[model samples]
Target: NAGVTQTPKFRILKIGQSMTLQCTQDMNHNYMYWYRQDPGMGLKLIYYSVGAGITDKGEVPNGYNVSRSTTEDFPLRLELAAPSQTSVYFCASSYSSGGHEQYFGPGTRLTVT
Candidate 1:
């Protein structure tokens, strides 16, 4: 609650299943981002929002959708999940974008079988 927090630490879904990965921050950051980390690979941005009511796609946003209805919440929705969607998802928040310090959540491990 003090920083970024993510729900459902771990989850497993069969092919075609869908889920929403929840994220929240108490720091009231205006910049929020979502990223996914695959095994042995660096994190790839899925989506980002500068503030509530403004959202944009990132490096890898094909299978994901995000909405920032409020400053505290940014949820990632995985639609028609596939095996390639399996990865560790991270949520981060910062007062400003680019070079600013960011607070990251513990992450949610999602496995799509």
Candidate 2:
């Protein structure tokens, strides 16, 4: 399986710049998630999708958006970056196999200056 992949492994943004974090998987999983981890903090859910054409807000969904139109691509949009958003962003997905494991991507280290 190809699993999940993210682009632009590292990025630094200004106070209000915008960017998109791309995530794609090839494992035919039905659930995908986006999370952010601060300097020394645990993972905070940003957004998640049960399947294509369906999406929902997570714990920390502010300043972010997501879409899942197919079974493979799920991208995260950062409308206005902020210092508070300076953290490591990770994309993860899990199969709907009755509480299966969540596989995480490498990560996107974002810095808001």
Candidate No. with top TM-score:
1
How high is the CA lDDT of each candidate model?
A: 0.94, 0.92
lDDT of 2 by residue, 17-83 (tens): 9999999999988999999998567999999999998899999999999999998989999999889
Q: Which candidate is the best by lDDT?
A: 1
What lDDT does candidate 2 reach at residue 12?
A: 93
Superposed model 2: Cα runs more than 4 Å off: none
- Candidate 1 lDDT over 38-95, as tens digits, reads 9789999999999999999999999899999999999999989999998999999999
